[model samples]
Target: MGKSLLVLENLSPGRNLDAYMQSVSAIPVLSVEEERELTERLHYQEDLDAARRLVMSHLRFVVHVAKSYSGYGLPLGDLIQEGNVGLMKAVKRFDPTVGVRLVSFAVHWIKAEMHEFILRNWRIVKVATTKAQRKMFFNLRSMKKGLGWMNNDEVEAIAADLGVDAKVVRQMEGRMAASDTAFDAPVSDDDDSAYQAPANYLEDHSADPAHQVEHQNWEEDSQRRLMQAMGELDERSQDILAQRWLSEDKATLHELAAKYQVSAERIRQLEKNAMKKIRVTMEA
Candidate 1:
């Protein structure tokens, strides 16, 4: 079974997917007793042959799971291969004493691998990153009521169903609708169309002299206004504000309280009042 299984595993679905599917489909599914025996051998005895047999008997299940993900626009053969990897992992970790069928247990591992593969290759930029976003990415298509963009009601419904924010649902929908555009125009594109590439329009403003001068002026003006506001405060208030905020070593409320011979609560109140005055002055 080991040698034969290895040969079957090497059957590149990319080369001939039909033949590969046929081969996997022909491998007989194990009965409950047979499955348990094989799983026990692999789990307790560390029998490699038993593991191979377990994986072989379940290859058809991997195919069945992979086919459902065909709408992702990835190669079906690659998806099946990924699912096969998951199946092998499931077989390796399966505990026969758990009292569950292998197919039922392996489904999670099978879909996990396929999901990872789809996320990795579906777009040049990843559409989903967080756990919530990943969940929405996979299910958003099915939940959508129409081919067009989802309305507010639909968005709200999907958000409630998926336990995510309505804004997040809209964001995921936008990401899904977006197609990857090359940074640079294709070489075959003529001058009329070449400027349409993101490379042409997404200019770097950081190095622009006029923009730099404007930012510097704004910062200097803000600093001047802040300093003038601080000058308007009494000497003690100025020191408190400076030590608490502008100083390299900031003073805690207790430290400032002790220095000023006031209670910590009094220090906090003074600090709050000072900040409020500063904000009013700055805004004025």
Candidate 2:
């Protein structure tokens, strides 16, 4: 299991959030030597405590990155929690031998987690699932800062910057601009706008008399075959089949066992035999 994430639901954002920010910021930045030493200990010795200290010291940086995602309307604490998970993963994989600072290497991982969290919760359904779409999704959100729609030059410029075709950029923008609405209307007394919803236009083609009769005939034929197959079993087997297979919320082996004063194993065996006999009879 992954690390359990912290939730923002319990945070009031009153005095407690202020205190948390102050406390985390006050944690002295690890010196170059100190960071290397801790990272090495965790890397070679597998010292979990060393890893924990490294994560804690970097919590403030996560806060700084999470602040940029505030406009997403998600809980700040949740964003920070996702960022923390990314930080831990970076710590576990970091190599001080690579000749790069830990924070510099960790920035990509931190934003990746935060970006996923925002995209998932930003809409009722996901807008982007592939790598190409993910690039377009974020680029379009940034481009939407000013307007009803983008001008031609603006779209081309964004396409060039993101290395996608201008036509693809326009399509992505159009998708992002659309909004979702309920399929059905609310209970309303006003006749003027009541029929404006899609529910009024949705057709139930199966309500036709010919289709209804066909469906009824199919059900009757299936039921007749089921009864004929069940009759191939003995009386006790039929009762067991009815209770275990045909009942709504069919009986469990334990329930059948209690009813017949037998072990659950015996009930299961009988049920299995009854089913096999029915299947074989139906096949014949």
Candidate 3:
């Protein structure tokens, strides 16, 4: 008799990977005859249990494929889970009439999901994208052994072998060899050797505490000077400057001209002169 359906439902894939694998592995693989029969049932009869058995039997194969992608630094469990999902998709779509093994058909879908996961999670800076770059990201690592840097001949050879441009190979090579460096030096640099850190030579004046404070004071002083200069103007000038320059509902030259009963050209001249005076006062 088949295993109790209720007992099988208790199985959690994440509780223990080993237990999950062992349990799924215990589901007998279909023989050629058995596979044909079960696949036929799933394909035509739409039997859910047959689909379940077909999926369960292939879990070990998914684990095998997941292991090959171990260098990507993503959690193996997550990769396996993604692969399992792909496997199910394959099972659902498998045609028993075509007469191919389920594992053979599922391999493409399983790797596709795992590849997407790796591309997303592998690094903050995405090293690879595009169909060609994706091919290079995985294979190029293996090609680069003993790395000071690949010489031009080596780059050309790798490019030729991989069916890609030499320039692309050079770019991928540079990305792989590169490492992230901090903008500031570490706190523990006490010796003269600490001068080697990037922070010593590449100074950022904008980030300096003293400079930042001075900048704030200068901005405030400029604003005060501008306001003082505006105070020197007549009431009409003050209103024009405030409404035309400062307030949220800014007054245009035409609007100010209509209000003061002058040509738009005259209003434009007054506004320009006011800006120049403000600049001179602020500089002083």
- Badly placed stretches (over 4 Å) of model 2 are 1-16, 143-145, 186-197, 204-284
Count of steric clashes across candidates, in order: 0, 0, 0
Using lDDT as the measure, the top candidate is 1
Model 1, 1-284: lDDT tens digits are 44546667778778889978887877777888899899999999999989988888988888889889998889999999899899999998888888999998999999989989999999999999887678889899767877799888888888899888999898989999999999999999999999999999999999899999999999999999999999999999999999999899999999999998999999999999999999999999
User: RMSD in angstroms, all models?
Assistant: 5.1, 11.2, 5.8
Model 1: which residue pairs collide?
none
Cα lDDT tens digits for candidate 3, 49-166: 8898888778879888998998766778889889999999999999987868888899999999998888887766777878878889878877876657888888888899998899
lDDT of 2 by residue, 225-282 (tens): 8899888788878988898777898888898789889999998899899898877876
Output the number of the TM-score-best candidate.
1
Residue pair clashes in candidate 3: none
Please give each candidate's TM-score.
0.71, 0.65, 0.62
lDDT of model 3, residue 32: 87
Query: How does candidate 2 fare on TM-score?
Result: 0.65
What would you estimate as the lDDT of candidate 3? Answer: 0.81
Between prediction 1 and prediction 3, the one with superior lDDT is: 1
Which scores higher on lDDT, 1 or 2?
1
Model 1 steric clash total: 0
Compute the lDDT of residue 197 as modeled in candidate 3: 78
